[model samples]
Every structure is written in C-alpha cells, then in structure tokens.
Target: MPWSAMRRVIDVSGDGGNNSGPPVEQARGRSVAERIVINGLAIAKDHPPFAYAGPVPLEDYYREAVIGGPGAFVVPAEDFNQFASAVRRKMIREMAGLPSRPRMALAD
Candidate 1:
C-alpha cells in the first residue's frame, strides 16, 4: 500500500538499545519526512534482572533515539509506578494534536 494515503507509525520501547531490529536513524528519517509522528515511552526502572536494562536517563535516550516528525514527543516514566499515567498523558496529548513547549539548553 502507498504510504501517502495511510498513517504509519513506529512506536519503539525497550529496556535496552536497538540491539535486535532495523536501525533507528533510518526509521526516524522515513517517518518524519512522511509526516508520521513517532512517539516514545521509556521505562526508567523495571523489576528484577531486567531492571538495569533500561536507560539511565530515559527521556534523554528518547530524544536521541526514538522521537521524530514535526511535533514528535518523548515522555518518560521515572519507574514502573508512573508508567501508566505517563503513557496515558502522552497518548492524550499526541491524539489531541497538542504542541510542545520550547526546549531550553544550558550554555557552556
């Protein structure tokens, strides 16, 4: 099927890096150019042996790894306790077509 007439999104969530799928950069490029928003949710802490697998700074990782498109958003859950609420808020914002606030960076 042609992509222009369809909406395609690649939602990527993992405890670790892209060790088992297609390269993320390529995926981001295509999705963004095609106007498909790639929203991300990263769990900062998981249970048991899998706990350490998640990124230390999940929001940072999402910014660097998963989100794409004009208004892409990457919302992080500090731990499993906040996962559901975070995911709900992210989805609601995305679905409602809300715009993100400007981001600031510190100068050295």
Candidate 2:
C-alpha cells in the first residue's frame, strides 16, 4: 500500500530541544501543512548532562513548537529509565487511534 494511504506520523523523540536544525516550529508548520501528524516523546530529566536550548518545561516546548497536525501531542518520560514504557504507551495510543491528551503515563 502507498504511504499516502496510511497515517503519516512523525515521532520526534529527543532528550533536548532542537539544538541543530531549522527552527522547530517552522518545521512543524511545514509538516502540519502537509497533513502529517507530529507527536513528541520528550525525555525530561532533572539534571540534564547537556544544556537545553529551549525554554523550561520541555513538554510545553514540545507541545507548542514540536507537535502539530490533528491530535498531535507530547508524552514525557522523566528519564531514559522510563523511555521504553513511554514509547510503548505512545505507540499503543497512536495505533489505537486514541484522541490526543497531554498526560504523563505513570509506570505500572
């Protein structure tokens, strides 16, 4: 099947904001314009080894500057320790076609 026949989703997973690239919001705008959904898996840490270029509240940065298109949203994982489950949950929701809701998934 052609890619156009399926949902076009870009999973933007990162430990920091867009450090080296075109402005994230501009890229998101371009993707949204193309009818592509952009979801974020932000690995927010209490003490990041590297400096984050964007504002505080990484999830908020993702929501505003990274995610776009219908039902686009962000899922935050506190650290790499939680990355696997966060990804699992994100994939489940996306595959299930669940409506977007900005909420952290507590580890089970």
The numbered model that scores best in TM-score is 2
C-alpha RMSD between model 2 and the true structure? 9.0
Q: What is the lDDT of residue 13 in candidate 2?
A: 95
Model 2 over residues 19-91: C-alpha lDDT tens digits?
A: 7978988988999999999999998876745535466688888987899999888999988899999999899
lDDT of 1 at 1: 50
Mind sharing the TM-score for model 2? 0.80
lDDT of 1 by residue, 45-65 (tens): 656666645444667767887
- For lDDT, the strongest prediction is 2
Q: Where does candidate 2 stray beyond 4 Å?
A: 1-3, 51-53, 98-108
Which residue pairs of candidate 2 clash? none
lDDT for each of the candidates? Answer: 0.73, 0.85
Q: For each candidate, how many residue pairs have backbone atoms clashing (under 3 Å)?
A: 0, 0
